[model samples]
Target chain A: MTTLTENPNVAATADTHHGPAKGLKRWLYTTNHKDIGSLYLWFAFIMFLIGGAMAMVIRAELFQPGLQIVDPHFFNQMTTVHGLIMVFGAVMPAFTGLANWMIPMMIGAPDMALPRMNNFSFWILPFAFLILIMTLFMEGGGPAFGWTFYAPLSTTYSSDTTALFVFSVHIMGISSIMGAINVIVTIWNMRAPGMTWMKMPLFVWTWFITAFLLIAVMPVLAGAVTMVLTDKFFGTSFFDAAGGGDPVMFQHIFWFFGHPEVYIMILPAFGVISAIVPTFARKPLFGYASMVYATASIALLSFVVWAHHMFTTGMPLFGELFFMYCTMLISVPTGVKVFNWVATLWRGSISFEVPMLFALAFIVLFTIGGFSGLMLAITPVDFQYHDTYFVVAHFHYVLVTGAVFSIIAAAYYWLPKWTGVMYDVTLAKAHFWCSLISVNLLFFPMHFVGLAGMPRRIPDYSLQFADFNQWISIGGFAFGLSQLIFLALLIKACRKQGKPVDAKVWDGAEGLEWEVASPAPYHTFSTPPKIK
Target chain B: MTRANLVLLRKLVLVVFGMFLFGFALVPLYDTFCEITGINGRIIVKAEDSDADKVVSDRRVKIQFLVKTDAKNEFDFKSNQKFIEVKIGELSEVSFEVKNKTSSLQLAQAVPSVSPGTASLYLNKTECFCFSQQILQANETVVYPMRFFIDEDLPEDISLLTLSYTLYQAQSVQASYSKSELDKGAS
Candidate 1:
């Protein structure tokens, strides 16, 4: 039973009591994974607030319909920036942040294999967001195309500021790719001696796959946006038909990157759920091997299903059918993951801690989101659903309730470990219940309205859709405000004046993370633990 | 460095370079796909009934009607003039001039529906295209730009096709105004 300590050269001589780096130098030149991880988390939180405010503006406009608060154009800008910020700035970074904080501790690693690059990865984000928000003040205003930035709309008719949007996205993609590379390398190289591939935590495995997906597709996004920039400013007609470019082709290229991007948002959430469920249930994870395979299957399926988003854009029938089948197949693996979580909870001593509560909610609500996704995968069904409030409902269910919820769950589950202080159970559970109910109220009716043919991205809608839109707005505002409770809880927890936690925070916890003391130090695993 | 460490470094360089190559080749590969999917617009030659009946002179007279929109609501609507056929390899700017054909002053956006319902006409302003929706006085003629040239890739079988605009009048605040609403417009 050899451990990192067995290698005295690596362990006894290694700095065990390494505190976080000091001053501006600590932030700029430090390679500490936890510091970099915190940087990512704080940056993501700020972007979430900014992006959330944009959503409030969007909801305010849609509250009563008829283009009440903002012009359809500015409303569009809100929609575009809101989407870009949330997907890249909020969800992706949150997951990356979690990966940074947890992976080394979970897998018994000393540190991320490349830590300087990790710092570079995080700092790039604020600048990217700043450039993007600045575009709102530009000559024609920021990008008004939906986050998808579908062609002709993005290319031919776009604003002068779209060039700025393109450049900012390029930098964001670079950051994501670098961050992902660091994850993949650390996972591959730094695992403790006895921590075999199967022994790795689900969080690490899912991120390992997610990182690969990010690397493969984010570059494609950068390339797609680059073409748009050239098309707009350089007189190239990559999307201009007069110059022999087809606009539909731009869609093909963009979605090739985009569909995988969707999976990138959710896969790590799957990993987080997998980790949280077993720990709370006081049982071993059901079908652990299957969970791994299912994650891999989802990532593979992601690439082929990009065309599902473009079905109504008039793709060839064969392409449509191929993408449809590929997309539906994903539901099988996703369903397996869900079943495993529920099955783990079955016949076990399960108590609803804040983390467990959010986890359980994720299982139910994400499945609901998954079912809608299955419905959207059917080409004929999607033809009816595309660009409608239904698509909006489907994603918000998965994202706000699905990915964002998992992040909250993971936060609560690990907060004790990260801060050595237990959160207020009453307040944390209150946040969970309010979020779950309000989120459903917000997004569930969108399915009905979307099915009834309410198009999305329109500042105003026809009278028939008015009632549901109003209800959705109320739910949205409530959900947005409820997040403030989470912010307050986090602040209170970080102050370290709450319930004291033992080394293993959860009764059924496994993995190197719980093996370490709560409130993980600046440098953990200076000597990696033996897994076996 | 240890042998294992050296192997790891080599693998890292290869993987990184491989990824770089994949990214560098992406645009060209996408361009190839685009070229394959792109439909070379047809050259449509249709004589008026006079040419069709052989009643017109052999000396060919080419008449081009420029299609243009008023630059108001220009981007609000998606337009396609791609199906409109012109002579192959012809060096003429086929313009669709959209006159505020309405009697009352109207701010109208014109889209040159070309490029197979996928291409939008990008309008650059002579000055600043400051207002997306132009303010046209009654009986004012502000020509919108939907200028494009017939590509050299036109096929021989196709002939004359028409580029027509069925312009819809936008709802203007002058005709129907509100303070809260007017303040929110994207100028």
Candidate 2:
């Protein structure tokens, strides 16, 4: 108060200095949402690469039916750790990183509602993943119980380093919860005047719902892992039948969290697609209200459908019917979303930018994944698909093609805004086509082999599955290599090698984010912009 | 960041804590749900009926016995008769011989589960060796007896049921152990 009265000009000058700081401290100690967002994106990408490499090892081992590159145990570790890293370390974090960068900009807030909390959440992820990866080198190797880590397998037969895995997952849960709280608070309070609930961008709306899902389920995951920890180390039998508990309860509790978790990874992708599809098509989205409701409905139905994952786990017939029907019901809202995107593209001036290409692929492939999920929801049919490569193929289409591809799309969509330079168009196109073909090749064959009775998480397969496995491995390698083009494109954009882009880099792009200068000023909308 | 926002923040934090407790609550909640729905195939004891002497002699049902032992703990477990045909409402007895292959004293328990899950409600155990821990001397073999009956009310469509006992070895079965409220791995 005294400074404003005695030296008003000095206070004014300090407030006007909005450029970023000079060195590594700018990232390490800064609370700037953009810087922290960059940190998270980089961390997620690195984790993605590590997880993808593990997938490569898995595919290589499966290439010829007999273990060639790694032992069976190591291959189990690869599959388990690969799942853990991708779900927690790659897809979830990438969505969060995008929220940090874009949410405040969309809502016209100067920064995240709690900037320090943002930094804390991002920093813990690397450490948590480090602890998890460290277990691979420890005795007994990493978790071989698969990512689901069901009882008996997780409890009786798990590696000695199970405690480390539990603690690492616990850390991730905490980080996610804290990150979610920040998101909810930011969107709830920081919208610019006149930017009412319905007026907010689809990205912001999806994130708001996703934040709730995070808060609701991440704790359940923590509880599940805690039970696993106690059952193994503390002599408790939360999932042990001999001790008056049942292992089937583990599946119930886990899928409660796990099912919503599946949506948490994809809901934001819905938001990204909703935003991009309209921008490229040059159409004000076909069914914005329905899209929001659809996202909400999908989230709500997620709780009831968790048991669909456990259909073959031996649930009662009624339970099976209920879950199967509920799982299929999600398709209703999901179909609404798919329809909205297609409708937006109908009779519109569509241009296929790199982001649009990924978005279009996301819609088609995610639908395929959704359809397969529906197929598995039928209890009797799931018995056939359970533990098979078909299950593997289903999730990858949604995750790699759905959630992951959307993240890549968002990055390309906004990279010009964040970097002030365009990414190399030709290289990006090549990256897109190669990824499109290879990703399909990688996941598509798994469906065939899965249906043909090839169980997943095995290092060796029968002679019959040999050909499809070869094609799958080749596809996996190609997909893995294709990502390098992305890495190169990103490096070039960051170096400002490409031509500069003005604010509103895309002709039809619309948002507060584009109203500011390219490479958005370090402190934007300092005085919140009015929506009108 | 603002006063109203802080309130929102506080409420969200409470939701986080509440959800954590809710996760733990699901344990008991699950048990209660399973008990009510009979979804998990937990065998509930039935009242001794005076009419139980009327074993439906003409109608035949097959009882297949299965024992599951952890491969880690070297042990031999076998049902004396792999299967037996008994009339509905008939009392049947089976013996399982288990030997502790390990050289030290070890504790073992068999958790029984009925398959075709709905059959769990139709079957009642007169005496079964579960819940109570079985402590055997080093390399000792023990034969445990189980007595059970298929209730006359068992569905006509089902003629066979598998009674599986999953054998587990623990240092101890804590006295604090209680039946999980509702669910069993029976299915």
Candidate 3:
């Protein structure tokens, strides 16, 4: 293994001192991708639980729909923080963590191209969330304006903590922008010698497009928050109608960043599903090139179809029609990707490994989410569904069962390689089954209540919605508690208490990542592997 | 980082900055878009020809006037008429009565929004109180007049349009009053 004479630089960097540094110092001062990746994963896990707890509080208060536990303002704060923490703290960071760990390994690169910036990006997140979380304890309390934070609600009528909310968002934007730049540069500069653009894995391709979308929109979010800051503290009338600025303008700016931000969360899930379906089915991904095109088309269409979110905000008939048509057009590319996933699974010797189970659920459940989204895209119909619980159900199906299930699948898929041990198969399958059943029970009924005219972001509801709300809250609590099983399983695997795994952890897994030793020698591809 | 990496980072940084500016740019961009399409019912009233000869149609539109005062503003304001029937392209005048209920002299500005948003483009104001800030003495009451007409091209389907004006306390005037009060206290 010591081929120092062959490649002296590789030998020097891959010397015996290659494992992680001592304890806290390793995570603090290290620029290694794997260590940083682990840090990101653990951090995201904690945020996920915290965000989940907020959701529980919301569910508890809405359990009987009479505000039994908390006040309306606190409930509003819970809802707002719950969404913020999940989107920025849990989901996006989790994807970035996956990217950090897997991108270098899959591409046959030694490390991310900009390692120091990677460290900077990861570290900024905790502090941003700290400031955001601290706001709940402040005098006026955290942002009560929904995560959308429309004008007046977030500005003149908001509490004192709105400024802190704005700044926390700014730092988060900086961290995301830096993270995206590092990804784009690494992929652009660090692929193995034989790996052409076409030869790259689906995960890498999806992330490449996702990174570009992040760079394009995160700054717009920064700008939107900045205006919110000015309007609240400084003397800017950006969203105040009396000062000749329109409140609807804030919606335009927000959803412009916002709509793409939704895709940014899910595109990587597509990548994860694309990888898993082929592995479990023991076939190459069908229409891989077309899948790539579909992902790109979705990202492109995301930019123009933003106003579909603003259909009820008084758009002209032509404007509404244009956005309606554009929004519906997205279903085409999205449909192509779904078709390709099913095609890859068609008649193949598919195994229901934990990862495969989650992937299959993703295909079916995510398509349900997509169909709801298409219904929401119809301009007139959306007028009824705009702020309803139906909209809430649609996104949660996509985000919770869709994006989050992919993260879990990726975790199970890669856990063996990361830990050098096989997880308990029975426990992993049970966890998947619990999550699958409980997540549907939680979000599926939201569509029915939403159609029956239950509005979102409120502490109490009419007694008519009582029965369904009780079931949804029960499902929510079960889903929340079930995740602890995942936590225990992950902790057990990390302690190396399970049976040892081999270099190629799965029988059908294909990628440079599987070619390395289990527990993945702290520094892999010291000499870049030749493709073909 | 290598020089090439540094250059690429710089270029990407510029793109981020450009998008940040683009976010702010969307303000004016939205305004122009709305103005052109009358999407949000924000109408820019340019002085239109008020000549009686300009009447091209005898279609009558029911124009409803609505007035609201901000919660923070101490003013009594109401439209003289709840609704009026006016022929398209024929000039009409409507007045709103405003009285300063506060002890101090105050200034107010009215912001107007037209509903059935498509009708905003057809509702022309030859002269309107919303064009300038109105200053009133303590306990002063005045009838403010707005002269306007509906264009003959007003959407055929829209027979009724609601014109609403919300009066807000002018910030500049409030700031000046506060400063003067502080100065008097010091003296």
Candidate 4:
């Protein structure tokens, strides 16, 4: 086994012996991390567009409250498929793509510890999604049961395509498990000699914790879908009340997987913001050790707080109290993270670059989502908010503004390094402003309508909710269109049509990644770089 | 993978497998939790009237009876009375009438649940029709009796309690029973 040493001038002996293979085989057979990262990213973008179109169908239907576009059953399919696609296909794969591209570069590693397995992990995702999307063209229509796919709704009362949903989810779980395993092995075995745990970049640290979480919870999800499959086909009574099983038990198990899944989506975003906030502020990160500890605490607390999602399922009083308190405890570490970001920008030479603007918006907007989450964590109040549009508003805020925005920020921050050309600043800023205004228009009114008793997963609403629904639909359209601007900007940059960038694109950026040339060579750190 | 790295990866794989089993283990774990807290309203049936010699209380508690049958079950089932007032610690008898409307022999089992779930521990059954499966020939009708009592230690605030029983086809139960019987014959 070769060990990395702290030598700053090791680039002379670095391996750049071979160039990439040409055409389709390059993507299909390559073990290069950057190439694999691009493949994962482009795939996630396509899934995002498809999922967004489903959301468009939903919004168009809800524009007038009486099923203006699609029928009610089809409407249910839209909501269900939209949720499954965005969470699994879009957001998760995008993060994994970013990890693939960035972790090795940031930690000064030659490549992922298990490169062949990384190739296998990326290839399985498309097949998984194919089975999932194909369910829509089947006889009885795709899974109309909400994304949660609760028992009975997904089993006895479901369409024939329910079996496909279960299998698709199983394959997705396999892909995620393999991806997470590769990340854990890469970060664990491949860091440079001087890159001790504390000295590692925050992005690497966050992915380290997130990978552990994925390994722990993805199997529980596998167990859950397995039970659903058995109950539907094998006549098992795992969720059948008449057969001595309880429906509420299914909720407990799913949420045990689900709450941690929420963290898996967001924790990496925290790492992204940590890197961006410090760079734009022209200062070192505030309370670095505290941020790492806070992240670990949040991941640990996620396990005990799963039942907060099941507060209305008639749990015992003690059980309710325990989950409520545990859920609320998450806010402390989350508060520390928010405070650290704000302090990092306190009294420094702050810049309003595209990435910085997104980071700032993330701090403000994600906190709004967090505050709403705190309200939902109160068990008694959740009874009012459960299955309502307010619940919808809260999650969209965290996911769209919180997770998706950070991803956009990371793209803009690293585009120069990836493509060797600078992206159009004016167009990027326009995209950000349009999204910021329209996403609020899309989701903010949902809280009011939801509080006014507008139930989710329905095609029709009372006339009282008609006006807000119209405005929300309009906002949805604007947000969807705004993404096209981002697409245009990405294409221009990737074509290398803009001016070439220096190795360190941002004046304030610091890391091993900045030490390499712009448009990072296909094989980086053939001999690992030394850190002081 | 190096030997140590291989060992670590194997350990992580084991953890994943262990958690998967833990998911299934949650079923039995949930049952044990409910048994301890009596939060799911599931009742425990005793074979004989061991608490018959206990003193009866003067306090009266309103007991409401509810009965239902599975959607696929071809049986007509109903309670003798909708509601009754019974004194705590006094053994009370209630009967359910059931008729198997199917054309063939069928087995059925009743699963009992109580409302105000905390009261499940206080409501004990000395003998219940739910204790075992009942086999009925075509068009057979029978009155099934359940003997139970609200313990004297019942909380004062709960003046009303609901007892519900749902009947289900006992195919799996019968299958297991026949397997055990076959074992007995062999032994």
RMSD of 3: 5.3
Residue A485 of candidate 1: its Cα lDDT? 88
Residue A395's lDDT within candidate 4 is 97
lDDT of 4 by residue, A462-497 (tens): 999999999999999999999999988877787676
Show model 1 residue runs off by greater than 4 Å. A1-18, B1-187
> Candidate 3 residues B24-78, lDDT tens each?
9998788788878787887764555566456657788899988999889689999
Ranking by DockQ: 2, 4, 3, 1
For model 2, the superposed segments whose C-alpha errors exceed 4 Å read: A1-18, B45-60, B72-76, B90-106, B135-145, B179-187
TM-score: the better of candidates 1 and 3: 3
Model 1 scores a C-alpha lDDT of 0.73
Name the better of 1 and 2 by TM-score: 2
Q: Which has the better lDDT: candidate 1, or candidate 2?
A: 2
Classify candidate 3 by CAPRI docking class: acceptable
Q: Which residue pairs in model 4 clash with each other?
A: none
Model 2 Cα lDDT, one tens digit per residue, A319-421: 7888888888999999999999999999999999999999999999999999998888888989999989999999999999999999999999999888888
Give the per-residue Cα lDDT of candidate 2 at B19: 92
lDDT (CA) per prediction? 0.73, 0.86, 0.88, 0.87
TM-score of predicted structure 4: 0.95
Q: Candidate 1: what's its TM-score on chain B? A: 0.32
Q: Rank candidates by TM-score, best first.
A: 3, 4, 2, 1
User: On residues A411-504, what C-alpha lDDT tens digit does candidate 3 reach at each position?
Assistant: 9999888877888888898899899889988999999999999999989999999999999999999999889989888877876768988888
